[model samples]
Target: MSTEKPRPTFQMDGHDVPFDEGQSILAAALAAGRYVPYLCYHPEFQPHGSCKVCTVKINGRTHASCTTPAHEGDVVESNVDELNDMRKGLVQFLFTEGNHFCPSCEASGNCTLQAVGYDLGMTSAHYSPLFPDRPLDASHPEVLLDFNRCILCELCVRASALVDKKSVFSLAGRGIQKHLVVNAESGKLADTELSVDDKAMSVCPVGVILRKRRGFQVPIGERKYDEHPIREVAVQKQKGE
Candidate 1:
């Protein structure tokens, strides 16, 4: 058997946090019960750094928490109100760009995007809707894609690449016209290896990607997001780590 030394632990925001060698700043903070707001981040997937929502002030400068590795004596502060507002504004921009009709959505109560909106106190979307008449693909028989609800977070695309071990989803087109494209040639999700068990379905923050059978399985009141703020959940998850 091979022997290897374990990574050291450090203090962050008054809590002892362990960093396993290449563990990220965000991962370390989560282990220490510090609530850092983020989107486009999943523990089981690779860090893409596409979404700047998780940016934090590290040593008096902002850094993408997901991409920054945890080191000894690093000062990470996540409680700044300005940072909070920035995240809120990012969420607002995402909301205005998409057709996030909470009351009519199947993933309304349990969606992380919705929870973020509530945390930001965004009662209504102020910007004009893009109203892109994108196609809804229910060809997979187990998943549905409502492109109008997409936020281009790349979670679904990354999940298919990293977690599911299949590069099924990709971003087609460019700029304001970019969108989640399924497989090659055919736009149908069923044509690819994307299964119901894929992480892409679970990683989508908005109702853009949804499960065909699992929608509304849990009542609105019983959903994990309905009872607590996203910050509380992040803190609890951090503590559990």
Candidate 2:
């Protein structure tokens, strides 16, 4: 006779969703074909919960879904007006936090930030731009670092250290002063050992990192998020359906 324990189940919205033993709420939701909008919780990397865009109500209390574990009989609420409105506000804050001039950015149609903004129906940045005068780093002949569009998501940091096996990028400071830093004596990519083919090169979810001499190569309306919205792609990725 088999004596295996059954997988746990939870209530998301009005549906009974089953989850594996050690899966997070976000993981279970995505696995069950539910798309939870997230920024800092990529499946390839460990959950950081930095963006808090995946905030969902679990049993009438707020929790970061990517970090919170799923348990049996737990009630999870996502896609409600309250949570989505907060997501929109956070998206707008990310917009105003940097000089994300989308029209001029090379990552225009392919930017996750831009895609999420469109997904959330963000018409304009509700807050004023910080305009911090961050310098553009073009020290590398094959890459460019435009800090203006950086959302500080730290995808590059994770990819470099974990995927590429290079300790090249890291976050510095706290709160408003927080920013990405290259591990180099000259504080530049040219001085660092980062190559054009590194995983970190293509890991920026925004326009902060770009390959040199490759702008406008694909043109507008032909990008990844051009025809299909992020919601569709995200759902497809989650459910594998």
lDDT winner among the candidates? 2
* lDDT (Cα, tens digit) per residue for candidate 2, span 120-237: 8889988888888789999999999998887888899999999899878889999988888889988998888899888898878889889989999998999979999988777677
Runs in model 2 lying further than 4 Å from the true structure: 1-6, 239-241
Task: Tell me the TM-score of each prediction against the true structure.
Answer: 0.86, 0.93
Whole-model Cα lDDT of every candidate shown, in order: 0.78, 0.88
lDDT, candidate 2, at 95: 85
Best by TM-score: 2
Residue 164's lDDT within candidate 2 is 90
| Shift in Å, residue 90, candidate 1 | 0.9
Worst 10 residues of 2 by lDDT: 1-10
The 10-residue segment with the lowest total lDDT in model 1? 1-10
Error of 1 at 14 (Å): 6.3
The sequence of per-residue lDDT tens digits that candidate 1 reaches over residues 37-150 is 787887777787777788887777888899999887677766677887888888887877777778878877778888877877777677786766777898887878888788
lDDT of 1 at 175: 75
